[model samples]
Target: GDDMAILAALGLQSYRFSIEWARIEPEDGVFSQAALDHYQRCIDACLSRGLAPVLTYHHFTLPLWLARQGGMTSPEFPDRFARFCEHATRHLRGFDIACTINELNLPLFIREPLMARMTSEKALARIAAAEAVLHGSINSFFLYSPREVILNQGLAAHAKGRDAIKSVRSEIQVGVTFAVQDEQAEPGAEALRDQRREDFYGVCLDAVKGDDFIGVQTYSRVVSKRDGSSGPEEGHPRTVMGYEDRPQALAATCRFVWERTATPIIVTENGWAGDDDRRRAAFVPEALSELHDAIAEGVDVRGYFYWSLLDNYEWAAGYGPKFGLIGVDRATQQRRIKPSAVLLGDIARANALGADNRSAAAPQVMGDGAPVGL
Candidate 1:
């Protein structure tokens, strides 16, 4: 499916995409002019279609040479990242928003079994295999590679990277996005919830205070118990990702993150992951309503970019979990525009949802040449 044209057709105001660090800088000190030109074209493509381009510099991947040299733990990581950012931004002349790194908090792939989806022994074996392939303990956004050192390096990298991008495109709004949740507290769980919250987001939020904005990516809520985050509420609907279908979590998260950082908010991602197009169709309005209320209350949300435009790979989770308005048949490269696509497009065209400004419109098919779109 054509993402840029789809966004324009939907009448969405902006598009967010990542510039591949690995592709632009395949080797240390060796940058690709072709890679720079490719992303420059991508930026232009969005503008050519009347969509504002919101670019993310790093989205959980890195060049191989850097990974082989201890990855994020390498003493050279931050500077190398900044160097790449400055050089890349020079080619990217017109984009206005830049996220320095995506999801710098939560440690979503923190070697934890739930996220890694690997038993401990198999995890170790795969880690071994990673070492074999990269020649160093790989740190290129693996499902099991988020660690204190890695996140700490990311903090430094974000600072330097933000500066580098701003140095070239100072007019651009620079920021970082992190995974967030509603973080509801169960009985006697307030302390535990706050503790978990700090563990996941506190440090990163502290660092983001002065940035132009903070991107909050929330899919569901976490009902934290005294001991730990509880399983999804027993009676609530759940998504294929095994989380509660609480679209209102976006509101809770936006309020909390804005209170914490005082930076402007942009919903970097929020969507249900499943094959049920109705769930997505219903989810968008509920989430947007929540977001609308948050905005009404002055959370200062600048944008609400849905998690995705097409169903595609979901990191370690593979392609099983779907969170797209359009579905693709992998074998055919053919795209199926889901009902949710029309639903969201209608809301986008109306520029509002819920009872006040509901409208319906069919989706206009976009081109498929773009690597990723949202």
Candidate 2:
């Protein structure tokens, strides 16, 4: 397939892609061998091209049947997910690395009611409209209460899923991913920022402590003040997602997660979202340079997978945010590789950072260079 060929051309040694639960099991207690066979072809294609496939069992989409049954908050959710993982792993046995879930902490922040309450009226209206278009009705969104329930269920699902996969193939590596925001505090807000980090990520990071590795997905920097104000600063360059253009966030996030969990890290998702290929071209080298600095400093960082290989649908945002190294025409399904893809490909082929691409100044050190105690 074109995807495998392109990955091989770029000299990438690994490819990470997700399997849709809905596609594989459209109804409760029903399984489709055709879907399994289809994904098998994808796995075989990657192998033929000499690329190791890193498969993710879930990536934020629930089968309508599962959603109707209370999704993640359901007590049965973990067992159901583990059953699905057990089925999927039978087909994916040879692959050495598998992610049990993507962004386990995402549900806490993205629930409809929370967004409706926390965001501007205009932003809330846009989200409601997008939900209608994506799900056919705004009322269809899952609304779970007591945020702790969502976190607890996610942790349970991840633990069960990891165990299920390891049961099938004991040698396989299994872990869950987290979305880490590199939060900086204003002079009077250090404790507040620390508390926010604990509230958002601490539990999930603790859950994955004994797993194979943790997937750190970070893209920008957020500055928090004691008054609970937090967002990109006004003057910084922003990505299409409205995140500040802080390439060094990669290093800061790596160090932060390393200090907390002491688990091996894999950057499962990191990239800028924009239509300007030129900006992406420039952004990648800078981000990778920061990543290289993290590696040189004794963080057991394993690999980095760009956020995406193609511009595709982005949940409620739809196709508006472009985070791909390749562009696609929705009408004709045509593909065009962007300049940034080539830039990244060159770096992969060389297997070393280019001298010209080094950061002009020393990269920022995370956490005052102090030993972090969990």
Candidate 3:
């Protein structure tokens, strides 16, 4: 496919995409020179095309070594993941931009039924056994939601990761991306739900507060609670996921976050998924419009990177949800540019041109603004 060419065609200034950890480091502790070179080439290509590469150190993918180490939830995991982050940043020090972690707030652990069942059962048994062996030890406590554990561990690792990157290349700009959902305030529910959303910001803010940028992945509204009397609503607006579809609420949440944090924000992944292109485009425009409003209201919103350049495996759902601007033919890996892709390309071109013109016309400065020729 024309992955690199497509980026150039889009005239993109900045593009955010994840490098599957498994793809890069398939075997534990073993570095693949070929893969490393390939990524180096990819980064070079982005720079060649004038597109800043926003590298995601970890998405949902994990290395086998880390996976065997009980993934992110393992107590030993924070150190292990820190080492991995140190290693990754060491290798990717010269990238255009770095997002140390992606979607750290997503409820990926409990959402996947099979994995959740296995994780809960396995973790409980392990914790129970540990508690028995270390009955008096203070570190014997157990917690559910390995993903949550991962968040705690990953944030620490992210800090180490940042230091590691700067040690090698001090010029690289690094940050973190959180999957933030805007929640709607329920009727008669007071503003408690709003507080919960604000608390969610703590997770993101805590992770990237010291970083150069904040990548916020926003999608449908976050439903705080569903009315139980809705009579078995499975699909449509009344569905459980409907509470997460509040666009205005999401915008407000963004505004709140921007007000609280001085860091520049980037909409790393904010787009809709639909069966057809038209619906997808409509949703994207709406989201972008909300983002624009947020920016206009002084949100310090910087760049926008659509969730995905292409559809990939969505964990348990695999390839079920098509959220890509470019439709991927899974069988052959061929990509078809959807209408949203075209629209994004146009938007990028316009923004880049606008930025260029603004810069070119700005008056030159000389020695504390004194006359240059005098």
Candidates 1 and 2 compared by lDDT, better number: 2
Give the alpha carbon lDDT tens digit for every residue of 34-81 in model 2: 998888888888788877778889988888777666667668889999
User: What stretches of model 1 exceed 4 Å from their correct place?
Assistant: 114-119, 139-148, 227-229, 358-374
Top-scoring candidate (TM-score): 1
In the predicted model 1, the residue pairs found to clash are: 2-366, 2-367
Error of 1 at 21 (Å): 0.8
Residue-level lDDT tens digits of model 3 in 275-332? 5677666665565566666666667765666656676555656677666777788788
Off by over 4 Å in 2: 112-114, 117-142, 356-374
Which candidate tops lDDT? 2
lDDT of 3 at 267: 64
What TM-score does candidate 3 reach?
0.76
Candidate 2: lDDT over CA atoms?
Answer: 0.77
